[model samples]
Structure formats: C-alpha cells, structure tokens
Target: MTTAIIKPQWSPLTIALMVMGFIIFWPLGLAVLGYILWGEKFGGSPEKAQAYWNKGKAWCSSNAPRHHRNHWNRSSGMSSSGNAAFDDYRAEQLKRLDEERARLDAEIDAFHEYMANLNKAKDREEFDRFMNERRGSRQGYDQNKPDNGDNNNGWGSNNA
Candidate 1:
C-alpha cells in the first residue's frame, strides 16, 4: 500500500500552516481548512476526485436559494412533476399571477402620472398668486407717490 504524503489529520504542522495562511490572506486560510477537512477524497485517482466534485456540486445546487432554482427552471421551461392535473393547476396559477402583476404595474404608472400632474397644477397656482400680489403692490406704490409735473418719470429732478 502506498502512503499519502499529507494525511488528513489534525497535526501541529497543519495547524501552524493554516494559521500562517490566514495571516497572509484569508482565502488561503479557508483553502487550507478545506484541504484539512476533505483532502482524503482528493488523494485518490482522478475518477474518485471527479466523483467527489460532482457530489459536492450536486449538493450545492440542491441547497441553492429558491429564486435561483426557479430561474433555472424558468429558463429550461416547465418540467413535469409526474402528475398532469397538478401541472395544469400550477400553470394556471402562474399565468394568473403574471396577469395580476401586469395590472398592478399599470396602476402604479397611472398613479405616478396623476401625482406629477397634481404637482404641476399646484406650482402654477402658487406662481399666479405671487404675480398678482406683486402687481398689486407696485400699483399701490405708484398711487401713493405725489404727482410732480416736471415729467422726470419717477426720478427726482436736479431742480431740488
């Protein structure tokens, strides 16, 4: 029997290496820890290592988040779940949900448009009120000025 160089066991040398790896870079430390944990599966022939890799890949895919799994399923089209009635029900429900989402999106757009129009009207009203008040103040000031007939056009003459 051939003995492997680095046996997968907790030794002082391995621990020290792992610690050093961490001090150098974090991913290096993580890689060292993974080797310490699962290096036995990779020490054999290529076929054994490939089999272990495939197993780990399968485990990761199976444990992936629901949204990611659903995205894969959607890209591949609907797969049969072994029962026709259940499949039909699921398809119908998905279609209904999609239609409802579209309707809600349209409603949201309409609401944003209405709010924009309302804001514009409010701004116009405020601007009109400000203009009217400014005109009124200017007319009151013109009425209050005494009519000096020298025709200086509101500028006092040098004949003071």
Candidate 2:
C-alpha cells in the first residue's frame, strides 16, 4: 500500500528573510514567500512532496558535520576553510568591493546622462541663435536695397 504523509517540517526564519527581501523589493519577497509556502504543494502531489522532503532530510541527517559547516558558511556569509577570522575578513572585503562597484556604475551612468543632456541643450540654443541671425540679415538686406520694379529693362538699362 502506498501511504501519503503530511509532515510538520518547516522553519520560520525563512519568513523573516522574506520580509527583509520585501523591504528591499516586493516582487522578490513575494516570489520567495510563495515558494516557501506553497512551492512543493503546487508543484506535485502530497506523496511526491513527501518523498522529496524525506530524501533531503535523510541526506542532511547522514551528513551532520557538513550540514553544520554549510549552515555556518551561509549564516556568516563566508566559507568554512578552517579559518574563521580570515573567512570573516574575506567576506567583508568582498561585500565592500561589490558595494563600491555598484556605486561607481551608478555614478558613471549619471555623469554620461548629464553630459548628453548638456550637449543637446547647447546644440539647440546655438541652432536657434544662428537662425535668428540669418533672419535678421535677410530683413536688413531687403530693407536697405532699392526696389525699382517700374522698369522692365533688366540690368542693361543705364536709367539710374
């Protein structure tokens, strides 16, 4: 007989992390929240989920020492290579470098955007000024020149 089991196996600390993610981005929060709450249930039947969960549970229980090391690595944001202090320092340095890279990327994008907008405005202003000067020159030339449209003798007539 194939029996189905609904086990009471879960953790609430994951929910806290989900909440923190929501504080960062709501969609990311929702995705992780939904996965933790209903991922296996929706993904498959109860028997399948039970089998999957049990398999993981068996594997973890079989590797208690590795599990502890992995847990430490995740919680401390550093790998367990037999040196705690060095691992902590390495994690800190990596985190700082990531933050610095993000900051520099944002600054570069902002600077490029600012320079593009400045050049566009300058070009527009210069074009408008040039058009204004051309219009003024045309109007002045028309106003100062002669308009003897009474004779049809072309420019061959010395009837000045």
Candidate number achieving the greatest TM-score relative to the actual structure: 1
Candidate 1, residues 1-160, lDDT tens digits: the string is 3387656667898888889999999899888898889887787578888998899999999899998898789657988777999999989999999999999999999999999999999999999999999999999999998986768786766685
Model 1 pairs in collision: none
Candidate 2 residue runs with Cα over 4 Å from true position = 1-82, 150-160
**Model 2, residue 12: displacement in angstroms?**
85
lDDT of 1 at 27: 94
- How do all models score by TM-score? 0.50, 0.40
Root-mean-square deviation of Cα positions for candidate 2 versus the true structure, in angstroms: 16.2
Lowest summed lDDT window (length 10), candidate 2: 1-10
Runs in model 1 deviating more than 4 A are 1-71, 154-160
Q: How many backbone clashes does candidate 2 have?
A: 0
Model 2 lDDT at residue 59: 89
